[model samples]
Target: MLLDKDGILQDVIPPRPPLQSLDSLPGSLAQKVYASLKQAILSLAFRPGERMRKSEICEELGVSRSPVTEAMTRLASEGLVDIVPQAGTYVTRFSMAEIHEGAFLREALELAAIETVATSITEEQLVLLRRNLRIQEALVRDEDIAGFYEMDAQMHELILSFTGYRRLAFLAETSWVHVNRARRLNLPSPGRMQATLAEHKAIIAALEARDPHAAREATRHHLRQLIKFLEPLVHERPELFANH
Candidate 1:
């Protein structure tokens, strides 16, 4: 059962859908399982700290224990799961420290990326960015919060891609796994989505103008918004967070 902010028992989490066949998927069985489980965890289908039973996962995915074990180990390494000896595996609880560290790294890498691309960004890239923004606007109008969040990530990634640094893009993707959880939790807040769209526009504008300083400031400002929005949530939903 899930617990509310007042620590009362709320509705139980429903069973997740069985994993589909991997025939058309691009990866190995283990990789596909890992991706599906990670998406479920990040999407909050598996609540924070909820136990993840291997037998159940094996049954759900129609796979053997080998691939499930491999997926769990990878998730554990990504800080998204905890495997305790003789106890069980569970979804990792939220950690403010980890979130902040992710934010810090994201700011550093993205700021550098934006600076590097400021003067050298091509028109095609600019068009791609604008197209992304237009899609985000439509998503916002439709109140498709989840779609908007995905697009938001894509927008930042487009900026980072201009740097031609594959490692930097990889780091940004990794760091966002932690930060994205916080954003998902806080997404229901009113006006947060609109605010994010405005912020993205600001950053894009600065980059288009070739003003690295403005772009850096805008990027820093956008990254910090998540922390500010999370302060009250951390207090209200203490059960969702870890002491670390």
Candidate 2:
């Protein structure tokens, strides 16, 4: 099932093909199934709070019940799904508390990362950042919201990578799952893409100037924008959010 941008309930749609090629993905059958399902949920193709039946999923993916059940269990552990006895499994609703928590963690880690790398960023790395911004500008012009969003994430990861702390990137990536869901739900808001491009340019400018404090501030501001965007959404689409 899916929910339209207006929060109206929509007819059920079969799961799209896995975002990544299954043959190229490195995982057992259960793990591959889990990855595919995770992407579906994150992309909102599965829809928040929609029930996920094992039989239906198996039929859609041409898989068996065991892999689908295992995948659902894994998703539940990641707080992406809830399994209720006798009630079946469901995609988890958005949680304001979780979103805030994720933002807090992401801000702290990313700030530290930028501060650490600001003074030492090599010219070569700066070139790559510039190239990314160029592509982002084109994406904005084309109104490729999904592509722009993906590049936004990659740019952050690139910044974090400069710190040489793989764990920092890993932590940021994990926290991003929650944030990305919220962003995707609230996407295509008027002028949001342009504003995002401007914000990203500011962060890059700070990096170019080798100003850690400025970069940290820009990154924080960028991350917080999502929270502001979501606050009104929670009120307008209460059905999409959890009670707690």
Estimate the TM-score for candidate 1: 0.90
Tens digit of lDDT per residue, candidate 2, span 17-68?
Answer: 4444456556799898898888888887777788987886787677889988
lDDT, candidate 1, 47-117, per-residue tens: 88889999988887789999999999999999999999999999999998899898888888888888889
lDDT of each: 0.84, 0.84
Candidate 1 lDDT trough over 10 residues, lowest sum? 1-10
The TM-score that candidate 2 achieves is 0.91
lDDT of 2 at 207: 94
Error of 2 at 57 (Å): 1.5
lDDT of 2 at 174: 88
Of the candidates shown, which would achieve the greatest lDDT relative to the real structure? 2
